[model samples]
Target: MSESRLHLHLHFHFLSLLFLSCVSPSYFSTTNPDDNSYVACGPHQAQVLTEFMNEFDSSHCNLSDPYNGVWCDNSTGAVTMLQLDDCLTGTLNPNSRLFMLHHLRYLDLSHNNFISSSLPSKFGSLNRSYPKRAHW
Candidate 1:
């Protein structure tokens, strides 16, 4: 497989592991090295999510880390909701890294400027485990 495909595959599995952590903890062990690293959400996703959060702050619309509008799980630092509705971001491009947030269950991209842009097809691939509701 190509490098991009590898990333997508890893992203999918990593997200699935994260969901498992929230649902079935038996199969998702943070104490184990291999299992722990599999769902780490690492630097790439952190960078992407951090950038997205900074770019799309609902209150101030400023770019800052540790910003508001990010809801992460306590047990897992994986981001589950990016509440960016009523944000000031101008547009979402086809290549926007937002689709990489596979673990997200509540994404509020409404009221943003998606002019001339449509949601990426991969966004449909994102899913949440049982009991975790997904709302756009």
Candidate 2:
């Protein structure tokens, strides 16, 4: 092969590797058992769970998960948790919220930099499905 063609092939392979590394889920950690960074609280204590999370540093800690370093209490069946605190300044992808909310019963997005315009109109559905309860 020509030298220029060989160099082009090598560049393409490198770019592909870089893209895969950034997008691969395995590159991030899942909120599963044996992953000790976070713990799963049961569903009945959703209120309490949210209260407790409010005290922590909710900034994206570079976690492997797409929730951007946020953790969850996945012990309650398949319920997931997403917390967006003041430290969050960037626009959040709507698709990410949809995916995380699929099996979630509790979400704490308080204190974030989110604007009403950035939120989806269907966001009301989240409240309907997972009604906020008093902290236990």
Candidate 1 per-residue lDDT, tens place, 1-136, comes to: 4433333322332222222222222222122222333333334446656444333323424323232344544356565655444333333444655666666766654444333334456655655321244333
Worst lDDT 10-window in candidate 2 = 12-21
Q: Clashing residue pairs, candidate 1?
A: none
C-alpha lDDT values of all predictions: 0.41, 0.37
Off by over 4 Å in 2: 1-24, 27-69, 72-79, 92-96, 115-118, 133-136
- The best candidate by TM-score is 1
Q: Which stretches of candidate 1 lie over 4 Å from their true place?
A: 1-45, 53-66, 127-136
TM-score of 1: 0.50
TM-scores for the candidates: 0.50, 0.39
